[model samples]
Target: MRKIPRWLARAPIPVFRLGIGGLLTKRLVMIEHRGRTSGLIREVVLETIKIDGDDVYVISGYGWSSQWLRNVKADPRVRMWSGWGRGVGALATILPRAEGLAVLDDYRTRHPGTVRALATGLEIEGFTVDGPLPEDITERMPLVRIRPRR
Candidate 1:
């Protein structure tokens, strides 16, 4: 799979810090999480998969080892800034494997092109752009549910 350039991947962070990130919030979200080892605030910009009321769903395309995922697993508390809502208190929960797959299916059905691109980018085999995804897709792309703490 092709990896995003470090600089380019993190470029949106400054925009969020500058308080003009709302423009991208409809499809993206900025999460402020406490680093597991560092115990310091760390930010990451992720694509918004689906929003169901106070819950926001996102994908961990980079897998379980992703820094953001690991950090969130260690400390579910997070601060979010997005169009749906912005708050300093939120919780990150790794959706159940079956549920994650369901969410992935929903996302794929609604945004085929986006899902195709993600599959292609991840170099996932057996996923036809115009057809159903592989059964074990959750291994490559897990879903996380973020919601208000209160």
Candidate 2:
């Protein structure tokens, strides 16, 4: 619900690049979008999961409240930097809420560590925000599938 801090956004770029450069399976991408409110360019490093063919999916524990979600909504045409030196320009489509939930379920089943961390974030005392995909989001969550622009 809050805009990402400028410093936090800028700080992670190098680490992301380093990780992506070092790891083969770990594909970190830089998603570039136009901010819905400010109309300014924004970028975020996201972990991408490749679906069938060129399709890619991203799920946020914060759901549609995240700025990246809003930006994608505002402009589906965006640039994706895959790994350290690869790039893909794609059209991002918001999948049905049910599909998003399904993807999240798959993620949970595949990555127990992620599920546990998310669960802890949701249930722990200090981290009070609802970090898990809520029923409400299952009803209206934005699940995006990015496809290469032809």
Best by TM-score: 1
List candidate 2 stretches off by more than 4 Å: 1-10, 14-27, 122-134, 139-141
lDDT of each: 0.81, 0.64
Measured on C-alpha atoms, candidate 1 has an lDDT of 0.81
For candidate 2, the per-residue lDDT at 4 reads 43
Q: What are the TM-scores, per candidate, against the unseen true structure?
A: 0.89, 0.71
User: Against the correct fold, how does model 1 do in TM-score?
Assistant: 0.89
User: How many clashes does the backbone of model 2 have?
Assistant: 0
Clash count (model 1, backbone only): 0
Residue-by-residue lDDT tens digits, candidate 1, 46-78: 999999997899998778768999999899999
Q: 23, model 1: CA deviation in Å?
A: 1.4
